[model samples]
Target: MKDFPAQYDLQDEDVLYFPHIPKTAGMTFRTILEDQFHNDDVCPATLNAQLKDYSQADYEKYRLFRGHINYVDIPQILSHKHLLLVTVLREPVARVISHYEYIRRMPGDPHYDMVKDMTLEEFAQGMPVGRLGKNVQTYYIAKLAQFDLNHLSPDEVFDLAKKQLDRLAFVGILERFQDSLFLLSYIFGWKPIINTRRENAAKDKKSKEEIPPSTIELIKQNSLLDIDLYQYAKELFETRFAEMQRDLLTKYGAFTHPQTVKEPMSSQVTQELLERHAEQRFLNLNPDISNSLSYDFVEPLRGTGWHRRESLNDRSGYRWIGPETSATLDFPVASDEDVIIEIKTICNYATTPDVAASLTLDVNGHPVQLEILYSDRGSSVRWFRAIVPKVALDNGRVFSRLTFRVNRVVSFTEVNPLNPDPRVVGIAVNSLKIFPVHAAKTESAALSVFELKSWRDVATFLEKHLGPGDKIAAPLVFQLKLPNEVLDYQTAFLSKVDFQWLILYKGTIENLNPILFNLLIHRFSPVFADGNFVVFTRQKQLPKLSFLALHVRALYEDRIKVPIKLYIIRQLKQIKSLFVRRSKQAETD
Candidate 1:
């Protein structure tokens, strides 16, 4: 169960499969694999000769099989060989553009010659345009599900591709190169190096403005399927990466590294390479400036020890307590710290004070001071806040259980003569918030997502305040809620912010991805987790961004806010489609 040999640990005889979808940073991943598995062992796999065609001994000898082949061409020996499936995905528009630019430079191919002198607009408007970058990524993955492209509708093919992606052991995002590398290393226990040097990246790439609007519109129009698939891939990438990070915490413990590692200067090999690379990637990503969100945003469903007693069967109905009915709540403390325990509850008693009952609240078996609730307030629901000293907590180890004993229930009918039944009901507990006393300050600064600029603003802030070696608290508490009110500060993962920012700001790849990786390590890690920030964004405005909004981040919207993430992704796709549709309509006119 140790984190080193992950739950998906590779066997000695395991076979790693890489469906090298073109322009997905596959060459970079392939290079990393070759270094780890020995160049001789990492063999090129092709459609002409699959694993089934190779002898058993040959298959056993080659640990890593990768090449640009049809997706469905996996060797039939998959059932017998332990297969570790992995791939990378890019933004559809960017990938398509990159593909065109790459092929546009080639002199040998007839297709390349056709587009060599012609502009992007000419290529788009040309007859038989389907041969170019239309749904190339989708076609690659869809082929895995149905060998014949005609077998399924485009939507059906995309759904199958996504369904199959969920089963993949790892799917890294090309836009999120460094973070993805860290995750792949963590997942497969490989020594991953940051290789920003892309293969087939044309020296003379066309600027976004240089490409005609008609061509750009056509690219979007033709690649809607790829756009959807890319989003799904992004979601999957972040999901598995979270699992890998959890494994790191389980095996390596928190904050084993507590400093911003500078990128290595012309170094040939690793360790420092990883540290520097990671540090550089995280450079611009500081969450503090984006908002005053604290660490409380994380909700630890497990290990933190907050639980509702299943034995009492309180889940099915309200925690109804008669005159003597008692209820207990338990919360775990990861580290001994002064915390204000907040409880939100709704009493069955409406506006009537017929329930003349006060429940005693005890923490760690001892009664604590809490404000008395009066039904006379006219509000049926109220929040009770109690400050508890750190020493008073039961925390003595990694996590100590803090028990809450509630009893002394008083019923309403006792005081109201007109009350029907005399039975008393205390409260139906709605939610609980156990946070450090100092976190009270972050509550007042619950800024809307609209108030914040780019995610870089948040990263820049976290880098200074919560950055590495700063002993504030492990996993700080923050209050981050999305405008949609679905993904609270806790459940949503935040690391993708750094990745998104990396893609947003362009320069030498050296400064962007590496420094963001640094931010991830120094500021974001010891594993920065929890629902700590709330993003208040309108559901209707999800797709549209300000002139300054990052289109790349918009493509992979999961890192922003949950609940409305789908809304944003859909909105972007819709807007793109509409823009294209209108442009075509104009051209026809």
Candidate 2:
């Protein structure tokens, strides 16, 4: 699909409409919603034939409407304006193959007898150009947007399909089942579940190697629209997931410095009391064993944030939080001297390093902070420690409720193909322990800082902050040699929300002109400026736009340092603004 830049705001009160595109995990989801949740307010339909039979009362009676319903006709049946549409999309080729296998397995179906002997290749070639077979997903999406597909071209259909998808509350990935379910949980405030079985699962599914190249190509050629649509959905999912993740990080991710609250033992102790503990070699060999416990070593995963086990494994009862999932532990905090929890986690990022998961320590039902886990290069063990403020504990309580949620997990089977393991193994946390930091008093107030000196440092810093959306102008170095020499001129660049660097260079107002500067072979022409404090405005109709408007300021010119510092500060501010805007945009969208 040609990129649809606009996104629709998925609002509350919109009808939860699930258009069950056949073979795209629809059966599995239906079983869970219908079989498992018998009391849920739902209007159900498993096949296309049932859609035409729905009445106005059917729409008004249920909160959830599930079917292999035509997207275009749902509105007409509903007699409503808003719909919180949701669906799962699969790989185009895999979906086609699954559709073929499912039809063959259905003995009661009318087409079953005729297609029992048909080869996958034959089926791919013979499947019609309508909503049931080739490019079926895209057809339904297009039909929903335009009410009919006959008037539009193939590319137009793709465009409309994407436009409709953007408005959806959630578009789940069939492969990223756990993660998708978590997104649904996060978006809808549903109790996220992980213990469900895969109902109506397909068996002996053929791999790409087993499918002939011609048959695969035939499917791909006919359903190119589905491929593009799937790709767009994937990107949208990642963006939305990342945005939600950042929120979780903000909500639960906290890093607290040493005692802002008055410490219980840091007060003055009387000389008489001190004499009572004097002179003995106080050899407490097994120190406070009662207070300290490790998650991996002894505690089974059976507490607050822990999900029930699906099938027992050697994993010591740990559940697969392949999505945004949480686990809770109760830690003893006797006297609140200082609560230190050390978490031992092992994860293999050999697969999707970019697709990392975040862990947030939630204390007393409040999210304290989140920590992101990413591999430096390969799979490895990570050690995380959360220091709970004594204030986190309830009045005179010995135990505190600690919940750990792996806020975000993204899986990419296509891009990196680097991680081939099927199950989205985020992080297998082995142990969580509560112990005193023996040197708690020695904890410093100052945070560790990285000082950038050389080009390499600058490069690293820039890489950490800036992405492709940003643009930087050279520092506006104006060494105005006045009639009388005076370095009294002051200058500082103010930060803007967009990723922009207004690098001002040496020149007077009248002498200003647009000079072309190239970055990675892309040409950028600086906006014409009159003088210092000149209002640089882009007319509402400028074709090309970049965030490079800057004010000229000439301070003591070192040539080596000032410009770089200015650029760095400008870039940093821009990055922060970009994140903020993105966060707000995500909430609305």
Specify the highest-lDDT model's number. 2
- Summed backbone clashes in each candidate are 53, 15
Per-model C-alpha lDDT, please? 0.49, 0.51
TM-score for predicted model 2 compared with the true structure: 0.43
lDDT of 1 at 146: 55
Residue 485 in candidate 1, Cα distance off native in Å:
80
Q: What root-mean-square deviation over C-alphas does model 2 reach?
A: 27.6
Q: Give stretches of model 1 more than 4 Å off.
A: 1-7, 45-61, 77-79, 113-131, 246-589
lDDT of 2 by residue, 1-589 (tens): 1132222323344566677887887866653443212223456565567756776776576666676766437766664656567788998889888888888999986678767898887777677765445788888767666676787788888898899888777788988776675556455433333434454668679788898898889888878889999999999887765664554434323322222312221112211111111111111222342545544422322233332233223433234444445555544455445565656554434324333336667777655643221111222544455666656655333346677766454453543576563444344565565665453223211101112133223224334434455443332111111111111112111232232333332332111222212121233333333332222222232233233333222211223245558789999999999999999999999
lDDT of 1 by residue, 1-589 (tens): 1112333456676877777776677775765555445334565564444544566566667777776756444545455776667778888777777766666667764467677776655554452422466677776766655556675777887887777676666777888787776666655544334453344455576666877787788878878887888887887666665565554444333234424322221222233343333332233232222211121211111111111111112322123333334544323353346776665455435323333235456665656776421111233544455667766675332223334334444445554667674444444544455666666544422222225354335334444334232222111112232111112111223433221111122211111333333434543322211122222221232333342234434422433345356679999999999999999999999
